[model samples]
Target: MKGCAFNVIIQLRELFNVEGQTVKIDDTVSAEELSALGGYEQYASDMRLLGKIANRAGVVTLSYAVSVTLRHLCDRCSEEFEREYGYELTHTLVTSLEDDGGEYEEDYILCPENALDLTELALSDLRLSLPTKILCREDCKGLCPECGKNLNEGGCDCGK
Candidate 1:
């Protein structure tokens, strides 16, 4: 079976003995791959990932900012529009069970194989940052229920 495209692995061999070392990350993730992550309706062709990863002993710290254009439906007016969003994410990676008290933690990734996969980690952060409701404008008049006409565009013939 093939692995997910977003599952980019990072080898830990070079960081074992290193401490306080930071690795800069600059990469682009396709919207197709991001859509597979399954939280939003539509995404731009590509999203930019920029940030750093710091290694200290067996523990690693991952911090990065993601920027992308999102296509959303306005809840009030029912119009489709595009919006730009940028946010930062941080995660802790541990290489051993003892590092996380012999159990899984939501905020930390367990990398027992001496490698870390960033696909799910990044997706979770992005979804959490998304707003529950998206609007094209603050004062959207919505659609006239009786006439089924967009009120924001113009008034409907329906009384009241």
Candidate 2:
């Protein structure tokens, strides 16, 4: 919210009226604010969001790609490392839900006021896309069970 680039609000009124209308947004989100959200890893760099909202044949949709670098401690070896991650996300936007029963709530984003908060939407999507398990590498040997030495470096004194 403190950053300038990611705090974008789009008026969906025009997009809904015209078919094949598209609006593109490119911005950077602050790493400090994102890291303060309380996650296992910290964001080392600002997140880059490149996205487009389009009305195709009366269907309005939002599609975006997010990229960022994270600093994490390996779950197995306890080594600190940084890794880059990218996610492609898409969602259908609707002014209102056809039914009040909320059956199709998850299938679409409702913008009843004809406005969309791109910052909040992108942040929510990014948080959901984070990985559960983190490792330095797929084949990490991990620490020695007995002496607590990193097995990836070499064998420990108490062989197992």
Candidate 3:
């Protein structure tokens, strides 16, 4: 398969040694790529991933933190705001070249090309890690329904 510039590809041959080793990954990937891999709302230009990947017993595990500054329109106010989010994610990877009609686990990843793509894994974790509702602030007054005014900024003519 063709690899993109931002796709995190790790060669399967790297896990040859029995002793586990740590691989550090730190990079910025575009929101479009992430959204495609996982059903995540892509409001940020790029997402940052920084953490470690370890391989043990032919299984690869990733433990990392993902950070993104998303440009979101407040759900209540409809006002634009930048929200920063940090998510810590961990996942176990499966490298399967062929399907032997065996039962597969939920987190089983089929890496037929011998190059594991971690971009999808990271995006999946991000999707699950994100909050259901994204708010600018806890005490946000939101917009006045009647006059469509930002109540957080100031009072509106539509008296409560």
Q: TM per model?
A: 0.79, 0.78, 0.71
Best-to-worst TM-score order: 1, 2, 3
RMSD of each: 2.9, 3.1, 4.1
lDDT of 1 by residue, 46-154 (tens): 7788877788765788888888888888997778988888888787777776856678777676777767666556666767887777788778888887887889888
Over the stretch 29-83, how does candidate 2's per-residue lDDT look in tens digits?
A: 6787565544555888988889899999999989988888888899899999999
Candidate 2 lDDT for residue 19 = 99
What pairs collide in candidate 1? Answer: none
Q: In model 3, what is the error at residue 159, expressed in angstroms?
A: 4.5
Model 3, position 85, has a per-residue lDDT of 79
Whichever of 2 and 3 has more lDDT, that candidate is 2
- Comparing 1 and 3 on lDDT, the stronger one: 1
Those runs of model 3 whose alpha carbons end farther than 4 Å from true positions after fitting are 1-3, 16-21, 30-46, 96-112
Model 2 stretches astray by more than 4 angstroms = 1-6, 36-40, 99-107
